[model samples]
Target: MLQQVSFPLRTECPPGACVCERERLLAEPDADLRPLRLTRMEEQKLIDRIEGIASYEELKRLQDRIRTNLGVELKITPSPNEVRTLRGIVILLEDRPGLCKKVRQSIPAAVRKALERHPEITYAILDANDLFGM
Candidate 1:
């Protein structure tokens, strides 16, 4: 007697081709998800770094640090209204599949908090929708 084994279908999605439920949930701001909490020190450090951002280069470095340290991808761009100020800069946290749900939920708030505390980066309208577009 010969036994046959069947392999499961691939679970990973190609770039820009994901249609999974998890991805859908992550994209929804109102979706109920457990939050991942950062330590007090980590939050403070993030806030300090955001407050210190005086140029696009610093923002890029901060993105790199976040990706490396937190295993999360964020696309940061300056808003179209002004290039001279950090106030309108936009930070888009990539909602790619397989990202930790809790982490994905927590970062927007943390970043928003940082932006609020920043002297130069404060948004004229400190709305999460405007800043993070999560």
Candidate 2:
């Protein structure tokens, strides 16, 4: 007979620290789940990419690149007023399933192009959100 399995959220680790408890559980003979972990350098790269951006136009360019290269519908909604700071480019995209994979696949190239197109852009951040009220 098949049994239902549930994983618990670990609260002991610090806010951004990586956890591998799920992996440990999966290693069990009867466990039915898999866990994923990213190396420290990989995590740092993600933080740098998201935090290094500097302008809305750069964000738009990245979004356009993703749409063109990945065939993903990425919409960027910039704030009405422009605030110039080192905060970089921040964008909100509809969080449909599988969209993240497309964004991930396209980002490296898109970022490279954005850098070449706009020297002012230092970083870009793409955040996903649920658009459907469901």
Candidate 3:
């Protein structure tokens, strides 16, 4: 039972804040779905990485790291969570069905590599909407 939900994209929406509710839902860790499961610290690290992004050059570097290390191209952009009234950037790695599960599972390694290799990314979601359109 998958459906398409529209997410608003702000003009200056490069890593504003993350829409929390939807992300919470996707990250609930129900065995039925394989949303990336991160420990609390890891989650904070992920957010830190996102917040660390202060410039476009840093963003491009993060993108390159993900592609080079993970062999995946990602679209780094701002994402908004209307329910939580927050906005942040999310890294769109892939969109094919169930692909997020794979990405989510691999996020820890990816995050470590990206943060280590660049040490400047200072910055990171998985959702169907975020998926197809990220």
Candidate 4:
């Protein structure tokens, strides 16, 4: 039998603080859902809504709406100079068991795909190991 558990969503900041509510919702097990359920038309509607947002508050509201409605977390990171120069992205992935091997096997293809997607992102390099101060 499936049991419903209600957990209080806690935030370190006030209700409107950056990512507080989304973090709380993410922490709740019952809130996790797949993003693939949204149809292409619905996704287009959301993209239009996001594009129309004019302020930070509106953007945050849109993010929250997407998280609740679509269950997709959009992670946008600024590329460093090396990454922009097509030299590579030195990503120090978490030092866990077999992580190095996994990164070595997977990151090159992912990097290629990213480069293909963004003209500005010329290259990507994932350094799963500590290669500094040798």
Candidate with maximal TM-score = 1
What is the C-alpha lDDT profile of model 3 across 43-127, one tens digit per residue?
4565467446555466567667655633456664445553221124444555432223434435544544454454334332223
Off by over 4 Å in 3: 1-46, 76-91, 96-134
- The order of the candidates by TM-score, greatest first, is 1, 4, 3, 2
Query: What's the TM-score of every candidate structure?
Result: 0.38, 0.27, 0.31, 0.34
lDDT of 4 by residue, 1-134 (tens): 22243432222334443332344444555654233234345544554554444443454465466557545443223344333443344322222221123222233334334444554332111221222314
**Model 1 agreement with the true structure over 89-131: per-residue lDDT tens digits:** 6666776443444445456655555555554444333342255
Quantify all predictions' global Cα lDDT against the true fold: 0.51, 0.40, 0.42, 0.38
Task: Rank the candidate models, highest lDDT first.
Answer: 1, 3, 2, 4
Lowest lDDT block of 10, candidate 3: 5-14
lDDT of 4 at 29: 58
RMSD of 2: 11.6
Model 1 / residue 97 / CA error / Å: 3.2
Off by over 4 Å in 4: 1-33, 80-134
**How would you encode candidate 2's per-residue C-alpha lDDT over 1-134 as one tens digit per residue?**
33234533222234334333443443465642311222234434544553455675646664565455334444443234543432333333444322333333344444444444554443232222222225
